[model samples]
Target: MNKSLITNLVAALLLVAGVLLNNTLLSLVGLFALSGGLTNWLAIHMLFEKVPGLVGSGVIPAQFEAFKNAIKTLMMEQFFTQANIDRFVSGQDSQVHLHLQPVIEKVDLSPSFDKLVDVIMNSSFGSMLSMFGGASALTPLKEPFVLNMKQSLIELTQQESFIELLKNQIDQPNVMAEIRAKSKKLLMPG
Candidate 1:
């Protein structure tokens, strides 16, 4: 078991023993046990509450909201952004196989491939070719496109900031808070 579980179990055991023994020494042990158990309970409670009757407690959630926000910001910036994957291009001079995996791990390549096929079919060249050709003519294009996308993603991941930003963002409150506090005086609405 983990340290917390072990400590909790020990506290419970001490409390039970102390209550059963019924003496001054046992009372002291009971107090120690109770303090541990109560403190742990209060700590857990404070995580989600403004503890109704407490004198000064239950500020964990509100006070650390920035910590939660920073985590959300990290998730959005690193794993849910289109810009992260779109930079990886390998097609023509400007076109690239933007890998969605970096930002969107859940990608359905078939739909995209099908959309490409539809676009090709709707094009003038595609219409002329299809008038005399078959759908099999475009089957060879799918794998190459997928492979190009893979290569582009590989290229983008090599950027140092891609992974570094995760740590940098986590550490931002410590580094940027001072700078932000100082810069705030510049905006006095004069």
Candidate 2:
């Protein structure tokens, strides 16, 4: 049995015993206990059910749309605000640089070297290059090129214009609309 039901039952038994024994104090205590238990039970019930003639009952179902709007507002205004975005970007700067190392390591500079070789092969250096090892001579430069590119990218991200551009893109009206639409779809999920 529910705790409230057990409480009410005990309260009822106390009231009956008080009446039989003619004790006013016991009767009053019983009445208070009964009233408190019943009121708590009724309030809980009102949260889920529409009580007849009772205003604001079944509140969860009644205010579901408002709840969804509140969720969307909280997500967009509080969580995705400009200040929050700036904080996140600032925090990830070092992380971004670290992650770029693997990408730089994976880069293949052979194609670029081949193109350079083709250009040189067609120029005045063509005959002289034929004596040299051609594109294979550029293999030693790959590590330095990758390192320079990575450093350049890290420097680019540190610029104020780069952060400002990111903020502008996130703050765009279309982007906000798309976010709102996706949030609604996630919450409602038809």
Candidate 3:
């Protein structure tokens, strides 16, 4: 059985045996044990269960909502503060870099190549190009041009200089503050 039940049973038995044998010391000890056990049991019970005549029983259930709100407030104010978030982000190593090669590969540079062709056709070289196949002559260059452009962009972005520049931009006070604020808004929305 549970400790509370065992304690109460033992104490009650002690009290009955002591009284039947006319032993004052045993009786006193039994009375104290029984009173203490019952008192502790009642206290523990009162915390979780309401008693009709008790003023402040079942306090945990009664203030459950308040307790939840208090815990949320504590988490927000202490652990999820703006400074804490900023510190967490800032503490990361400078070597942390964003991998953009996959994104660059997915980019459609066809529009860019078309724009270039339009520029070339409208330029002073337009009349000379009309003598040949005109823009269609450049049409064959589209695939190669897009491929080369994407490769160049991927290389440029992967360069240490570009990574450093990007890191510096992100490390700017205004940028970091804005990032922290946005993260906070996302994490602790109303």
Ranking by TM-score: 3, 2, 1
Question: What does candidate 3 score on TM?
Answer: 0.56
TM-score of each: 0.31, 0.39, 0.56
Which candidate number has the best lDDT? 3
* lDDT per residue (tens digit) for residues 56-148 in model 1: 466666767676667656765574344432232212335443343566334446667778878877787787768656456778878787667
Residue 122's lDDT within candidate 2 is 82
Note the Cα lDDT for every prediction shown: 0.60, 0.73, 0.84
The most accurate candidate by TM-score is 3
lDDT, residue 74, candidate 2: 81
User: 1-190, model 2: which lDDT tens digit per residue?
Assistant: 8778899999988888889999999988888899988999999899989998999999978888898788877876786665555445454434422234456557675566567667877898877766777656656876676567666766775677876676667557676666666755775577
- Candidate 3 — which residues are off by over 4 angstroms? 1-95
lDDT of 3 by residue, 1-190 (tens): 7988898889988898899999988888889999999999999999999999999999989998887778767776897666765555554634455889999999999999999999999998977898898999899999999999999999999898987787677778788778766656665567
lDDT of 2: 0.73
Worst 10 residues of 2 by lDDT: 92-101
Cα error, candidate 2, residue 27 (Å): 1.3
